[model samples]
Target: MTSKLTLSVFTAPSRPVNGPPAIPAPQGGWTWPPTAATLIAGEREAILVDTVPTVEDSRKLADWIEASGKELTTIYITHGHIDHYLGSSTLVDRFPRARLVATEAVARDIKTEAESGNDRDFYGQMFVDELCSTVIEPEVLADHRLELEGHDVIAVATGQSDVKDSSYIHVPDLSAVIVGDIAYNDVHPTLIGSDHESRLAWIQTLSQIQDLKPSIVVAAHRRSDATNNAEVLADTIAYLQKVDRFLPGNRLQCSSLSR
Candidate 1:
C-alpha cells in the first residue's frame, strides 16, 4: 500500500512588544521573533507537533487546526520547552479528543519547568501584556513511533538540543522531518538554551538527521526567507562551528554574523 502523508508549517513570527514592561525594547528596539507549531496531517486525521508560547498564538493555532477538516488525534510534543508546549493546554481544551503525547522524560521536564513557574515568570513577563499562564504536561507515550494514517513516523529522541529531552519527527515515506528547535535557518541559534558542550552534541544530532537524507526539514522557528533544504543544515552547522571557535575566546556572542 502506498502512504500519502502531507505536511504543513504554521509560524507565528515575533512581535515588537508585549507584557507590562515589553522587554526594554531590545538593542535596536526590535522584539524577539515568534515560533512554530507544525501540523502533520493525513487524509482523515492530523497530528500536531509543539505549540507557540503565548495563549493568543496557541489559540490561533487551535483555530487553524479546527478548520482543517480532519480529526485531531494527537498533539505530539517533541520537547517540553515553554515555546514548544506552552500552548498545549489551550489546544487540548479546543480539541478534547486530541491526546497530548510526549516522551516520559519530556513530560517530567514539562512538569518540572511548570513547577518552577518559568512559564509565568519568564514567558508571561516577556510576551503577553498580561501575565500569560500555562498548564497540562501531556500523556507520556511509551513508544517513539507515531502511526499517522498508517504511515510510520519514526521518532529521533535527541537528548540535548537547545534544551534537554528533545526529539524529532521523521516521516520516511515523504523524506520529511519535523525538527523542533533542533535546527534553525536564517536566524541565530539561541545561545541561551545551549552552551559549548551541548552545542557540540547538537551538531552530532544534526549529523544523524543528515544521515537520514531527508528532502525537507522543518525548523520550529525560522526566517520567512529560508527554505527547507540541506543548505539550512549547513548553515546551522557553520553557525555552531563559528560559535565553538570564537565564544570561549570571547570573539562573538548571539549577534547575527555574515551567513
Candidate 2:
C-alpha cells in the first residue's frame, strides 16, 4: 500500500528589513513580509520546502520538525531568495543527514549569493544579532524530484515570478503546490526589478499553476492569519495584471513599487 502524505506550513512573522530612514517606516522599521516554509511528510520520512532567514527562526522551525518525529530526507529550496535559504546552515547543523538541494539555476544563484558579502552587509542589519553566521548552499537537484515514503514530489520550474529561477513543488498525491514567491496572499507582491514583460510572464506562470488544479496552494509570502488555498492563484494573477496595466514606458521607479 502507498503511504499517505501530509503537509504542514510554518509561517514566520513579519520582520524589519532595515532600510534607510527616507522610506516610510512602519512598525518602527521597514517591515518585510512574512514567509512560509512547508513540510511534506509520510509514515517515516519527510521533505522540507524552503527555510527561514534568521538562525532563531530556523531553530524554531527545526524544533517544529523535531516534534513530528519524522526523518528529514531532503531540504529543497524553491528559489534563490535570501529569506528562503539563508537559514539553511542552521537546519543542516540540526539535521546532519538531510541533503539540501535545488535546481541548477537556483543552486548557482544561491552559491553566488552565499559567497558574496553583499547579502551579509544588507540582511545583517535587518536581522541584527539573529542572522546565522554561515550559509550552506544547496546542491543541484539532479532529478528535479523528491520522494517521501514512495510518493513523488515533483519540482516545476516557472521561469520568473518576482525572481529568476523560481519554482514550485507539486505533490500530486496531496493535490498540493508550494509556490515560492510566485503567489502572494494578503501581502503585496514584490516587483522591485520586474518590468511589464516580466509581470506578464508571472501572470502566465500563475495560469499554468491553475491548470495543475492543486487543491492546496502555499504562497511563500502571506498574511500571518491567511489560509492556504487554491484561491491565491487567481488573486496573484489579478494583482500582476493590474500592475502590468500601469507599467510606464520607462522602468518603474523604486518609489512607485514600494509596498
Candidate 3:
C-alpha cells in the first residue's frame, strides 16, 4: 500500500531526538517523548494533523507547510491536549487563511482548559515557558463529514479516551485515517481523564477505523507505520485490553484510579 503520510520527529530539550531513550515513569513511563505535530500535505491542499506544543515547534511545521507551496486550507485538531492544539496559534499566524477545524466538543474543551488555568502549566511542561500564553481558538466546528480538496473527511468523535474531545480524521479518498491518541505505534497509550466507557469507546472507534480499511494509519504521537488497518486496530485493542487486565478488576478503573 502506498503511504499517505510521512512522520517526522522534531528536536526538543526535555525530549531530545539524538539523546538516550527516555526512561518511562514508574507507573506510566513516558511512552513516547512529545514531538512536534504531524503535517499532512496532499495534491490539492495541505492539512496539518496536530500543532506542536510550542511556537518554535509550530514554526517548524509552518515552515514546512510554506515550503510545500500547497495551500494550507485546514488545520485538523485531533484532540484537546495542549500539545496538539496550543501550537495552532503559530500556524494561524503563518497561514491566516487556513481554517481551524475541530469538533464543538473540542472547542468547548479548549475553552474550559484555558479558563481553568491548567493550559498554561500543561504547555509550559511540554513546551517552553515562553510559549505558555499562545492559544488558538477554533474557527470551524465539524461534527460530521466535510468535503475539502476533493476529499470527504469525516470527524469521528472518540471523547474522553486519551484526552477529552478526542477525534479521528478519516480521508476516504486516500484510504487513510489520522488517529489522534486513540492508537500509538510502539508506545504505551496515554490515559488521562478517561473512564471505562471511554476506553471501550476508544476500542470501538478503532474497530470502526479497521472497518474503513485504510491503507495507511497516521498516529498523532508516533512515527507512521506502514501496516494494514486491521493490524493497527488489533494492536490498539490489545493495548487497551492490557490496561484493562492490569487493573485486576471486573470494572475497569477510571483514569484517576488507573494512575
**Candidate closest to the true structure, highest TM-score:** 2
Locate the minimum summed-lDDT window of 10 residues in model 1. 250-259
1-259 per-residue lDDT for model 3 (tens digits): 3334333333322232211235333454322344435455555566777777655656777787787777778887878877678778888888889988888788777777767868676445543234636666785564566556555677887754576457877777667777877776555576654456677777777777788788767666554333424466678789887776665334433232111
What ranking of all candidate models by TM-score puts the best one first?
A: 2, 1, 3
- Work out the TM-score per prediction: 0.88, 0.94, 0.77
lDDT of 1: 0.76
Q: Report backbone clashes per prediction.
A: 3, 0, 2
At residue 25, candidate 1 shows an lDDT of 47
Estimate the TM-score for candidate 1: 0.88
- lDDT, candidate 1, 126-222, per-residue tens: 5534323766877778888889878887777887777766888898888888888788877777766456778788788888889988898888878
lDDT of each: 0.76, 0.85, 0.64
Q: Tens digit of lDDT per residue, candidate 2, span 1-259?
A: 4679999999888775656667665545566778789999998989999998877788999999999999998999999888899878988989999999999889988888878867777778766447776777788887888877778999887698988679999999989999989999888988777887787888888999999899999998987789889999999998887777777433455632123
Off by over 4 Å in 2: 255-259
For candidate 3, the per-residue lDDT at 79 reads 80
